[model samples]
Target: MALPQKKQQKSDATAARLSALNLPEGGAWAREARGAAKARVEAMGLPHPRDEYWKYTRPETLVAPQAPKAATFAPYESAVFGDIDRVNLVFVDGVFDPARSDDPAIGGVEIEPLAGVAAKDIHWARDLYGVLEARGQAPVERPLAALNTAYATEGVVIRVTGKAAKPVNLSYLQEALDTDVMIHNLVKVEAGADLTLLENGPAAGRLSKVLEVEVADGGAFHHVRTQGRAHERRAATHIFARLGKESTFKSFTLTVNGALTRNEAVIEFTGDDAVAHVAGACLGDGKDFHHDDTVFITHDAVNCESRQVFKKVLRNGAVGVFQGKILVTPVAQKTDGYQISQSLLLDEDSQFLAKPELEIYADDVACSHGSTSGAIDEEGLFYLRSRGVPKAEATDLMVIAFVAEALEEIEDPVIAADVLSRLEGWLHRRRNG
Candidate 1:
C-alpha cells in the first residue's frame, strides 16, 4: 500500500532525526524497553503542524535535526526552591553530576541514576521505564515521549517504601548553548507510602523529558516543577501517571519564560476513591514566547475525582494554548471531574487558544470544563487605581490574584509560598523595565 505524502515525509524526518543520535547501551531488559520505544516512534513518526493537537503550536524547531540555538539568561534572583531543605540531584547538559549532587542515600527511599540501573541485569525500573509511556499512546500519539524513552541520555529511578521526611529535588543546569537533552525518569510509590518530587532548571537549549509515576493503594505522590526563565529555550515534557485505589496524585508547574514549551499530562485512576489533580501557571512576554498545556484524565474506577486547572498571563504578542479532556467510563460511577483553563491577556496583540472536552459513559458522573481568555477585570483595575495604586503595580497585583487559584493546587504551603514569591519577582522586574 502506498503511504500519504505528508505521512511519508514525517517518517523520513523521523528516520533522519534518529540517525543523528547515538542510542545508549544497557542490559537485556533496558535494551528491550528501548527497542520497543524505538519501534513506537518509528510507527508514529514526529508531530507536524497539520496534526489536530499540534495545530496550535509548531513542532519544526523541536523535530529538526539540529537544535535551535538558545542563549542562557542570567536571572535577577537565586534558584527556585533554594531555601527549602531537600536532597538535590543536579544534572548538567542532560548528564548526571554526582559532584554537585547530594548522596543518594535518603531514608525510606532508593534513588539510582538511570545509566547505572540500566546496566544492571535486573531492577525495579524494568517494569516501569517505558510501561506507562507505551500505555499513554492510545487516542493520541506522543512520538516525542517515545523518542525520549528510546534515547534518553540520563535521569533517575526512585522507589519510595515509606513516608519521605523531605522532598527530592532534580536541578538541571545548561552549560552549553547547543546541548540537546533527553531525560526519562521513573517513580514508584509502594502501598501506604508517600513521596514529593521538586524539579527546577533550564535544562538545555532543547529538551525532551518523560516522567512515569505509579502510585499504589493508600499511597500519595506530589510533584512541583518550575520551568526556568530561559527566554530562548525550547522544551517538551510529558507526565504519565497511574493511581491505585485510595491513592492521591497531585502535580503543579510554574513556567516563567521560554521561547517554546509544551507540557502534557496523562493520568488514569485504576482504583476506586483515587484523587488526581494537575495544574500550571505560566507568565509569558514578548512576541517569541509560546506555552501550551495539554492534559487528559481518565476515570476507570468508581468514586474517583480529578481536576485540571491552568492559568497563563500573556503580553506583547505572546501566545498561550490549552487542551484538556476528562473521560468517564461506565464503571466510573459517582466520579467528579473539573477542568478550567484561563488566560489574562495584557494586550490585544496576545492570544490564547483552548480546546476543552468531556466524554462520559456513566450517567451518574459529574464532569465540567470551562476555558476563558480575557483582559484584566476592569472593575478590579479601576478599584486599585482609585486607591492611589500605580497602574503598573495594580496590574501586577491583579495578575497575581488571577493565578492564585492554580497556585493553590500545590499541596505544600511552603512550596506554594516560594512559587508565589518567584512570581512576584518576575512581575517586579517586568514592571521596573
Candidate 2:
C-alpha cells in the first residue's frame, strides 16, 4: 500500500515546512529526520477506515495540511493539580521554557531538553525517533505524528540510568494560543532503571497534533496521560515503546475533554520476561465525539506477559472507541496475555465500540480477550434509590463503581486520590444534569 497522490503531496509539503524551520540547533539532523520520515510515510500510505487496524479510526481530518508556525505560549491555569508543587517541565506552544521548568538533579536520572542536550547523546533521537513510522503502524498514518516530526522546534528527553525510587512528572501545558501547533516528545529509559512518568496535555485552542513518547530496554516506564482540549481544537497522541529483558511498562490514559481526539499506545516486548500493563478511561459528554484509546502489545521473547483494560462512559451524543491487540510469537512460549474492554452508555443516543483480539503462535501460551457494552445497571440504581438516596445521587454511585476498577491500578496514592476526585466530579456533573 502507498499514500494516495494527494496525500503524497501533503507529505511533501510537510517536509518542506520542516526544511524551512532553520532551527538554531540541530538543524541538519532535524532536516534529515524529516526527509526520511516523509519517504517512509509515502511508502506506507495513509490508513483509512477500510484498514482492519484502523476500522474504528478514520484519519482524514489529521492528514489535512497544517500550519508550520511556532506555537505561541500563553498564560493559562490548571485546576487538575492546583498549585501542587513538584519538579515541572513547561512547554508553551511546543517549545521548552527553561525559566518555568525545574530539574531536581536527582541521582541515576538525566532530564534535559532535547534541543539543549549534546549531539553525542542525541543518538537515541536519531535511532528510535522515527522508527514508529518506518514500521507502518496504524497511528503513524496519523497526520499529527507526521507534523510533529516535520516541525517540532524542541522536545523533552529523560533517561533513567538505574533503578530509582522517586516519580518524575513531565507536565506539558499547551497554552491557548491562536496558532495551530505540533509537539514531538521522545523519552528513552536505559537498562536496569525503574521510573514513573506523568504526562499531561492541557490545551485550549485549535491545537492539532503531538507525538509524545518512546521507552527502551531493561527499563520500567509508567505513564499517566491526561488531555483536555476545547471543542475547536483537535488533539492526537502516539506513544511507542520497546521493552527489554525483565522490563516492565505500565500506562494509564484519561481523556476528559476534547471535541475530536484519539490516543494510541504501542508496546513491543522484545525480550524475555518483559511485562506490560496498558489501561485507559474516557469520559465524554455533550456532542463531543472522541475515539480515545488503543493498545498494541507484541511478545517476541519467551516468558512475557501483557495485560490491557479500557473503560468508557458516554453521554448525550458522545461516542467512544477502544481497540486492543495482543500478539505472541511462536518462540514466545509461556506468554500470558489478557485484555478486556467495557463501556457504559448513559443515554440512548450515546454509543461505544470495542474490538479486542489476540493472535498466538505459541500453543503453550495463555491468551484471552473480551469486550462488553451496555447501559447503566438498572438493578443497582434501583437498589440505591430504594434506600432513600436521591435518583441523581443513586445514578452517580453506579457510575462511580463502573470506573473505579481502572483507577485502582494507579500505584501512587497521591496521584490515585487526584484522579478519583476528578472522576467523582465528572460523575456528579453528569448525573445532576
Candidate 3:
C-alpha cells in the first residue's frame, strides 16, 4: 500500500528528529528499553500542529531540532518549597549537581540516578524504566515521552518501601539559554509504603521529561510540581502511573509562566479499591504564554475512584487548554470519576479551550465532567468595592478563590500555603506592572 503524502512527510520528519540524537550506552536492560522507546518514537512520530490532540497548542517550539533561546528569570520571591524540610535533588540544566544536592541515602527509600543505575545489570528500576510509558502509548500516542525514555541522560530512580520521613524534591535550574533538557525518572512504592515527591523549576530553554510510577498494594504516592517562572522556556512533561489494590495516587501541578508548556498524565488502576487524583493550576500572562494539560485515567478494577481538577488564569492574550478523559472498563463496576477544568480570563483577549470526555463499558458507574471559562464575577467585584477594598486587590482575591479548588488537591497544608503565596506574588507583580 502506498502511504499518503502527509503521512510520509510526518514519517520523514520523525526519522530526521530521531537521527539528530545520540543514544547513551547502557547496560543490557537499559539498552533494550532505550531501543524499544526509540522504535516507538519512530513509529508514532513527533507531535505536529495538525494532529488532532495538538491542534489547540502548537508543537513547533517543543519539536524543533534546536532549542529556542530563553532568558533566565529573576523573581522577587524565593524558590518554592524552600521553607519545607525535604531531601533536595538539584538538576542544573537537566544535569544533576551533587554539590548542591543532598546525598541520596534517605531512610526507608532507595534513590539512584538513572545514569548510574543504567550501568548496573540488576536493579529494581529495570522493571519500570519504560514499561508504564509504553503502556500509556495506547489509546493515544506520547512520542515526546518515548523520546525522553530513549535519550534522557539524567534523572533518578526511587523505590520506597516504608513511610518516608521527608519529602523528596527534584529541583531544576537553568543557566544556559539554549540548553535542551531530557530527563526520565522511575519510582516504585512497595506495598504499604508512602512517599511524596516535589518538583520545581523551569528546567531549561527547552525541556522534555517523563516520570513513571508504580504503586503497589496499600501504597500511596503524592506528587506536587511547580513549573518555574522562565517566560521563554518551553516544556513537555509526562507522568505514567499504575495503581495496585487499595493504592492511592495524587498529583498536582502549579505553572506560573512559560512561553509554551504541555503536561500529560496517564493513570491506570489494575487493582480494586484504588484511588487517583490529578489536578493543576496555572497563571499565564502576555501574548507569548501558552499552557496545556492533557490527562487520561483508566478504571479497570472494581470500586475504584478518580478525579481531575484544573484551573487557569489568563490575561494579555494568553492561551490555556485542557483535555481530560476517564475510561471505565467492564470490570470497573461501582467506579466513581469526576473532572472539571475552568479558566478565569482577566481580559477579553485571553482564551481557553477544553475537551472533556468519558467512556464507560461498565454498567454501574458514576462519572461527571465539566468545563467553564469566564471573567471575574462582576457582582463579587462590586461587593468588594462597596466594602472599601481596592479593585485590584479585590480581583486578585477573587483569582485566588477561583483556583482554590485545584490547589486543595495538595495534601500538605504547608506546601499548599507556599503555592498560594507564589500565586499571590505573581498577581501582585502583575498589578504593580
Instruction: Summing lDDT over every window of 10 consecutive residues in candidate 2, give the lowest-scoring window.
Output: 67-76
Q: How close is candidate 1 to the true structure, as a TM-score?
A: 0.98
* lDDT: the better of candidates 1 and 2: 1
Q: How displaced is residue 4 in candidate 2, in Å?
A: 7.9
Clashing pairs in 1: none
Question: What TM-score would you give candidate 2 relative to the actual structure?
Answer: 0.86
- Candidate 2, after superposition: displacement of residue 3 in Å? 12
Residue 28, model 2: Cα distance from true site in angstroms = 4.6
Q: Across residues 188-258, which tens digit of lDDT does each residue of candidate 2 receive?
A: 67877777776666543444444444445577777766664344456667777777888888888777756
Count the clashes in each prediction: 0, 1, 0
lDDT of each: 0.92, 0.67, 0.92
Candidate 3 weakest lDDT stretch, 10 residues:
1-10
* lDDT (10s digit) by residue, model 1, range 244-281: 99999999999989999999999999999999999999
